[model samples]
Target: MSILSDDIPALILIDIQKGFEDISSWGTERNNPEAEENARILLNLWRSKDFPIFHIQHCSSEPESLLNESNHGNDFKDIVSPLVGETIVKKNVNSAFIGTNLRKLLDTENISKVVIVGLTTDHCVSTTARMAGNYGYETYVVSDATATFDKVGVDGQLFSAQLMHETALASIHEEFGLVVSTKEIAQQIN
Candidate 1:
């Protein structure tokens, strides 16, 4: 009943890490509470259907990086858990497919479309969506499933966090990918 695609789509979650909530980084002003809420919604949908879900965590060897240590960087809370047979991917870059077995996993599952959700819309979310589109996968970016902080422009203008959020939603919705609400997505598979 999915209006988007019925070809077995996988929910691709990117960078929903504990470190991101720290809010002192560049994302502090851009990250929205809605991202966390939407992620939980997506998680519920995936669990209800027992569909393919892949959680991508970011990691780096650099001493000061956000996801440097295994113990601190690799833990996803109860709010996010791997289903019985779901895959977990650890990535260093924004693109979930880069340096990960994501492509192979999708191919193995015969998933031609991806329902993407998670944090920092301007960074990882946007990057992965662009990559997915370029890779020829039918991509759908959940509009409320992503968030970011407010940023200042070169002209000394400060952008509203909500506006930035809308821009990200606009950037992908019906352009690079289809943007749907969580309710719409849930009803499709419910």
Candidate 2:
């Protein structure tokens, strides 16, 4: 069955920034080398279709964080940068709706379904997807358009980045939202 409806869904891109490129600084192995490229393709498709697009920028409150506004890493990746008129939601937390007016904006526009794609699949993207589902929006997470890094478990065991990414998606699927591929979403929207 198609996860997407006939009604067009708004595109919400979360935290696709230069900060994610600093692998050494992040101190972890990463997966999905083509995430950015896949995100770019979706962004271009959304723009071409004149769909509502929102760019979520993470402005970390911590001074040492790479996403701090004062750092160059806070800048959006060139390929998925918000255009002059597209809405840019600045957030300090994982969920874009927490401190931002994203929910209100969507409400005003009558946007009930959202197609999400972006950085770290486990963090911001997953948080947003969960919240979106709870808020009654039919949310779809594009798996290939998001990536994450290896993490140390509570027991101090390291997990592969790919495993973490897939697990994150699996955890959200059929509960928070549907996990689809970039190609699947592209076909649905196009």
Candidate 3:
């Protein structure tokens, strides 16, 4: 059940921004209200060990978008905000690696494994997980530490937030990374 080893895994948090607080802007409703708290748990662990931690902030292109660089919503949520000396990678697209130096930073640090936790499981979180796997990193997506909102399908049927969240994790699990809980990560490190 251990997801880690002698090599320390970098903690990659994707888009845990204040913009996500606006459910209307993102979707109908979001699943896992405790996502930030759970991420905070893992973040503290990483900080305790002085492991590599990357905070990926999404900078939306739309000027009116909540995640736009000039908006206060673009700032990281207080629960899991980065401290001094932490690596902060700002990206415009879904994947943190796209149009950012995330890959280069990982390569420079010689990090072979990554533990990802953040907002919108079906979007940025999923995209980053997929890319991390493709990049040959041993990726682990924390299930309880990432979430998504309900969406209307093409047929106009409403999909539940919980359903969307679970499905996103499913797609990432095995293929992209191992979907685990915050507890699983803590157990491994402890």
Candidate 4:
């Protein structure tokens, strides 16, 4: 099947917030420095095409969390800020489908396909993509438009950010959805 079919898919951007800039505090190396740039490209494409777009904001409840609403870091990155009339879904959890009416809005609009992009590939992005698939949406995850940080495993082995990012994509590639790039999705749209 085509990455995008005749039905136009909604672009769901997850947690593209300024909090991610606190790399020092995150305590991990990161990959895909150009992820937000790629995400911007996709967002522009979606806007230019007049397609549906959903912005998922991660509002942390913890006072110490950078993503807490009171913190400046909780604001959406300027590059991917939501335009008027675009849907903004505030989520406290990993999956956008949870604690938000994202699924309901999609179903109401009859949006059967979704193009997802965002921060921390291994966390929120992966969880949302899995739920999107299980919820029966034809999901496409833009690899270059998302990124993750290096992590130390339970065995105390450190994994590179690139490795974790690719592994996360691979885990969901066939069963959950297709893992693609911004350029590829743009081509399909054209």
Candidate 5:
């Protein structure tokens, strides 16, 4: 369900940069490839509608860090040409709004709702979603549009991609924003 008077919705894509995939942290994940494909679908839809699309790129000054690489670090690939003139917010942290003009940009555009879709569901995606909600903007997490890899827990147990996806949905779906699929999002926009 859409929020009240929330007609101006921007799709905020967080940390879908190249480094996230190439880094050793997630290079061998089962859902990595699928997640990229799903993200592409959502990006295409938003681009087609000419909606305001913003991308957050994570970069670190450390020379050896994945985000510091010249070629692969935090750069969008050729497969996705971010719409011309769309703002690309550079960030050094997980939350896109932190120390960035993202919040100001949204406020300038009078955007009350944000449709979030990007890589690594448990990291930047989750953090940014929560932050957006805290900022009083209606946030929607497009499920297939976000994905994460397996991570070992403190209990010496590994959480699979599917498990992470489900857990994220359960935890933040209703509180932060409605959890939706790419298909459902497209239907709503159409």
Candidate 6:
């Protein structure tokens, strides 16, 4: 009786790139300094089990963007860098499924469960989670393993990074996907 589905989940790590380190470009403040560590924990767990893993990279079309293909920021941070065997899905949009063989690869592997973890909980993480759920996969968005930067509203009101992160998780929980914690996921091991 595991907490997750019987089918082994495919870990989907989104945009854990060096570009996100340019905090000034992202926002004044970012939440979850330990996000990468938590994601690493899950990554290690999956590796121990020899489960599927997909490393989603954002290849920005904008020349000035840090994630642009021509820059060092496009490279993955060492902590969660993809190994030789992991699948790398590069996308220009927020969703990982767009313009990529993410679905085909998942289907090819016969994987129907996905555990999503990554940078900016409110943006790419949320978008990918929504699409994963809509695609009929058993999706789980790891709350502590995802984070976001502060955002300014249309009227210039500042929203804290923590607020954005929480709301995004809440929005997806039990609707588009299940929002879970890394500890909860680890406890299911056995």
Judging by lDDT against the true structure, name the best candidate: 3
Q: Better model by TM-score, 2 or 5?
A: 2
Tell how far residue 51 is off in model 3, in angstroms: 0.6
- Model 1: residue 13 alpha-carbon error in angstroms: 1.1
- Please list all clashing residue pairs in model 4, or write none if there are none: none
lDDT of 3 by residue, 36-140 (tens): 999999999999999899999999999999999999999999999999889999999999999999999999999989999998899999999999999999999
Tell me the lDDT of candidate 3.
Answer: 0.93
Task: Please list the C-alpha lDDT of all candidates, in the order they appear.
Answer: 0.77, 0.91, 0.93, 0.93, 0.77, 0.93
Model 5 agreement with the true structure over 4-67: per-residue lDDT tens digits: 3448589887777777665455634545455566667768877887878898777766767777
Candidate 1 colliding pairs: 29-149, 29-150, 30-148, 30-149, 30-150, 31-148, 31-149
Where is model 1 poorest over a 10-residue stretch in terms of lDDT?
69-78
Candidate 4, RMSD to the unseen true structure = 1.0
**Which TM-score value belongs to model 1?**
0.87
lDDT of 1 at 130: 85
| lDDT for each residue of candidate 6 in 103-145, tens digit (9 for 90 to 100) | 9999999998899999879999999999999999988999999
Query: Which stretches of model 2 miss by more than 4 angstroms?
Result: 1-6
lDDT of 1 by residue, 1-190 (tens): 2544557678988887776666666543654577667778888777777778898887866767666755464456456756666788888888888899999989888888898888768778888888888888888888777777777789978887778778877887766788887887887777
- TM-score, every prediction: 0.87, 0.96, 0.98, 0.97, 0.89, 0.97
Clashing pairs in model 3, backbone N/Cα/C closer than 3 A: none
Top candidate when judged by TM-score against the true structure: 3
Indicate the TM-score of model 3: 0.98
Q: Alpha-carbon error at 48 in model 1, in Å?
A: 2.2
Candidate 6 stretches greater than 4 Å from native: 1-4
Compared with the true structure, the alpha-carbon lDDT of candidate 4 equals: 0.93
lDDT by residue (tens digit), candidate 2, 10-44: 99999999998998776478999999899999999
